[model samples]
Target: MFFKLRKPIFLLLSIPAIALVYIFLRNLSGYSINYQVSSPCACYKCLTDSDPWFNYNISENEFNWWKRLQTESRSFGVYGTTVANFFKIFPRNPDVIQPKPDHCRTCAVVGNSGNLRRSHYGPLIDLHEVVIRMNTGITRGFEKDVGNKTTHRVMYPESAVAVDDNTHFVPFPFKIQDFEWLINASTTGFTGRSYMPVKSKIKTNKDLVMVVNPAFMKYVHEVWLGNKGRYPSTGFMALILALHICDEVNVFGYGADSDGNRSHYWEILTNKGLRTGVHPGSYEYNIIQQLDQQQKIKFYEGLTKKM
Candidate 1:
């Protein structure tokens, strides 16, 4: 009995020593245990995968669920082949690099709500390390309200826009044809018919193109939005994407404008009845509000006009 009690006590005492040695080694390897424990955003658990790049190992169930989110009718085999071809041409590099403990990366997810019209948020928006704009969001002629700096642009074929060589031209591919369009658009120019007319060849640096993972998209839909609407909107996708890549996120130009209109800030509105169409706009906005309430993100509603 004496021997057993002594042995157990000795083993228990060794635990702290072992832990100290492990922590010392981790420090020597430039990994921070404290930062790992303390630095995650409030919704870090919801945001999985440090790298949201395409992989061939996506399961059939995931594919089926994600494909159903869009109106695409391509078979699983065709999707797989297209992804394979895409990787062959484009390097499967991680879009956002692993964050260091010393770095506090801030991001801005700028939407195209008309509320940003005279907000004068340019200087503030440009301060972020990463500025992610989406879907035909132009920075010209409105640089005072919307900053000229665009580090990443989230788009699909229908909402494609031109970005400088420095910007990461991220395509939120909804179908196999979208992948095909990216490949052909960069090389020989796309000629295939899509649901909407897409530019045959967009003037963007092919090397800077990044495709959003279908699995990540599915995660944003099911986990974040609780699978609401037909699928997640590009604005919502960019906001969630910011959560993973940024230590702190500041959102701007979502929801209705100062006049309570849902039109783009860049265009004049004739259709007052226009809504987000297929996306669950109100539900997504609620999620954003929840995140803001939880201090996970800073949502800037912009300036409200006075009567």
Candidate 2:
């Protein structure tokens, strides 16, 4: 009886030991098996590696293509007048704002998922050469998890927030008025307001403001995302932008949180089913997972099993 009992006891203890080892190895790999997903198509590799991922120096032919698409696509009603005004406001391409780095650039694209609440990823995020945050993601109270540094803040008129003089304010214009707003905001303190009525005068330095080409937004939706959703969310567009500019990209606070709720890290909601209506959240998440598996980008899920 003693011999039989000893063997069972050893087997019970070994089970927990094996579980611990599995968790340790998963953490060491910096990716969780839970998030792994296969790509929708094999062409994904070729698409991601293709040239002109961004509108760095958009050629005349590309401009014509974008204009033709704008006329056909009903998602965004970018008028001819707006396109002309956009050109006048921003004659130079996005390359003008790009920094000439002597060495490889490592970028961190920080989203606002609830998973980042107590992640202690602030230090790691700040270590990157370029840090890109979006919309109204605050750091004053959540610095311990989200980091305080901001090299770039990507937003549209509706989600615009004031950045410091040092930080770059990248405006993603969706309408003609948005282009007008940027120019007026920089020059005349923006008396006119949009339908949403954004801040008339932001505190950010005028010279640091960079406007993303509406064409680039179209490229992200059509080419990169394969028109998965109504349109690519700001966070998704920002990720592609980082991939173009940075040598290596690391994503944080994207997808659902620990409990699988679609919510921001700054605010948690009880409704797990809540998701962005306009954006294809599930499809986008799958693509992100595929990119991680392909080693094209690193997706930091935030808080490994140890935490």
Candidate 3:
């Protein structure tokens, strides 16, 4: 009985001793015992439920609904003529958005709000794994405030800009013609007319082009915005896309500037009274603040100085 009790006691005592020795050895080798913990997303389920890109697995109901969305004078063809051709050139699946366990993917969604004019967030923004910029937002003169690095550039045809070879050129298609336009722009040149003066041809690598899913746009309009405005603004859509793809998201250049005027960071405002034409600006601003309050994102309010 004594021998049996002694063996059990010795085994139990050796376990902690072995653990201590292992820790000591790790410390001696300049290795920290710290484990990386990922930040939990509060709305993960909601964000992941809908696929953000058009893929082969898209259900019939979703495809039908997305087809009927009218932007300008065009809608998707009933038999998916443009869509089938689109996948032949562009990738149906976006591999860039895949998440990894060992890596914490941080993203910065940069908008064109004038608030970013003097707010020096360039270095901080560049530190993120993914930096998403939209519309005519430029980094040439304002590289100090807005980082020169860009992972993704989101734009409609009217708001398109030339992106470098490394950056992913994401087109936000509002109508069916937009899909056809992307294919044309990459090949011959998009010479079609629109509500605004669109670039006749865009200069960028075609392989990196990723078109946003129409179903995702409908999801943003109905689920996220509760059918507010004509459709979600490009900036808001970029933010929503970041929320889904990124482990952590930082929002920059949103809302009115310190002067409370709606303007672009790179624009000289001739009309300081200009407001969002079709978007629900006030409602969108409120949702941004609410997300900030909930700790879902880190919202940087730029430039407190009155201009």
TM-score against native, each model: 0.81, 0.70, 0.78
Would you give me the overall lDDT of model 2? 0.62
RMSD of each: 12.3, 16.7, 16.3
Query: Each candidate: how many clashes?
Result: 0, 2, 0
Point to the candidate with the largest TM-score. Answer: 1
Name model 1 segments beyond 4 Å from true.
Answer: 1-56, 304-307
lDDT by residue for model 3 (218-248), tens: 6666655778887788999898778656767
* Top lDDT model: 1
How should the candidates be ordered by lDDT, best one leading?
1, 3, 2
Compared with the true structure, model 1 gives a TM-score of 0.81
lDDT score at residue 196, model 3, on the 0-100 scale: 84
The alpha-carbon lDDT assigned to residue 33 of candidate 1 equals 11
How well does candidate 3 score on lDDT at residue 271? 93
Candidate 1 per-residue lDDT over residues 113-152, each given as its tens digit: 9889888998899998899999899988999999999999
Off by over 4 Å in 2: 1-102, 270-273, 303-307
Give the C-alpha miss distance for residue 151 in model 1, angstroms: 0.4
- Across residues 26-82, which tens digit of lDDT does each residue of candidate 2 receive? 121122111113322222221122111111233344345544432434223344444
